[model samples]
Target: MPTTTRSESTQAALLEAARDVFAEKGYVNAKIADITGRAGRSIGSFYNYYDTKQQLLRALLERFPAQIVERARDGLSDDWAANIEAAVRAYFHTFRDYLPEMIGVFQLSMSDPDAAAWWRSQRAYGIASVLALIDAVEQDGDRIGLDHHVFASAIVSMLESYCWTWLAAGGDDVDAVFDEETAIHTLAAMWRRAMVGES
Candidate 1:
C-alpha cells in the first residue's frame, strides 16, 4: 500500500532525525517533540513508530554502526594503514553527516541507561578495530605487555576528540590542512614508538 510505504519512509526519516538529535543533544534531556519537528512529522505519527526517544535512539544507534561496518568492510584490506585511514574516514564522515542531529546523543548520555549501553557497544567495536590494527602492525617476538591496545585506543581517542573539536570549531580549509599534517606526523610517531625490533 502507498500508505504503508509512506509510513515506512516517515519512520525512517524520524529514526535518522532522532539519531542526529540524540548525537547532538544527548539522551537525557532530548525531547520527542523536538525530534518530530526535525523529522517534519506529526507528533502522533512519530509515536506510531516509536513510543519514546530512547527507543528511536537505540534503533538509530544500531543502524549507524551497521552502516559504518559495511563501509569499513568495503574498504577493508590486509593493509593496516589503508584500513585504518578508511575506517577513520568512514567514522568522521558519519560524524560529519550526523553532526546537526547528534546533539541529543552527545549532551545527555552520562546518565541514561540506554545510551550507556549503546556507547559500550560502540566503544567495543572501536576497541576491536584498534586491536586489529595493533595486531597487523606488531611483529612476532615484539615487546610484550606494552599495552598496545591502550596505546592504540589513546591514539584513536585523540583522533576522535580532535575530529569533534574540528567539527565544532567551524574553521576553514586551513584547519583541514592542519589536521591532515598533524595526524600523519603523529601516527608516524606512534608507529615508530611501537616498533620493538627491526622489521
Candidate 2:
C-alpha cells in the first residue's frame, strides 16, 4: 500500500513539475531534466511514469478541462444573447485556466499528425456545443442561412486563436492590461451578432 502511494505521489509531482516547466520554457523547448529537476526527482524517475516529454504532454492534455466548452448549456430563457455570453464565458474561463496545456498541445500538433487530429477533436467539441445552441434557435423558427458546421468551426477557431494570442502570448499591446470580463463580453457579443444577427 505504501509503495503504491509513493508511486502515485511521484507521478503527481512529475505532472505538476511538467506543468510549471512547460509554462516557463514551453513544450518544444522544455527538457526532461528540467522537468525532473523541478519535481526534485531523478531523471530516471521521470522515465518510470512517462517514456518521453510528448507522453507527459499527452497526459496533461488528458487532464485538461475540455468539456466546459464542449458541453455548454443554454439557460431557460428567451434571451439567446445572454445565453451566448454564458457559453462564451464558460469557454473563456476554461481556456484561461489551462492556457499552458493548450499551448503545449497546439505546439505538439504542428509536428505530430496525431496531436493535430487530437486538436481537431477538441475543436469538434466546441463545434458540437455551438451546433446544439444553433439547433435550438433554429427550432424556434429563426432562419439560419449559413452552414452550421463551418460557422461553428470559425467561432471555435476565433475563440482559441484570440485566447492564445492574448492570454498565452500576452495581448499585442503590452501596456494594456488583460480584462477577463471585457474579453468574454466582447467575444460573446460578436458571436451573438454573427449567429443571431443581434447585438
TM-scores, all candidates, are 0.69, 0.86
Pairs in clash, predicted candidate 2: none
Tens-digit lDDT track for model 1 on 44-96?
Answer: 99878777766676666565555656777888887665666567666666666
Distance from true location, Cα of 174 in model 1, Å: 13
Candidate lDDT scores, in order, read 0.64, 0.82
Q: What C-alpha lDDT, on a 0 to 100 scale, does residue 101 get in candidate 2?
A: 82
lDDT of 2 by residue, 1-199 (tens): 3456888989999999998998899999999999999999999999998988888887877744454745345333577767788787777777777777888988899999988987787677778878988998899888678999999999988988888898887678767777888888899989978976875
Q: How accurate locally is residue 170 in candidate 2, as Cα lDDT from 0 to 100?
A: 67
Best by lDDT: 2
- Candidate 2's displacement at residue 33, Å, is 1.2
lDDT of 2 at 186: 91
Instruction: Look at candidate 1 and tell me the lDDT of residue 156.
Output: 58
CA RMSD for every model? 4.6, 3.0
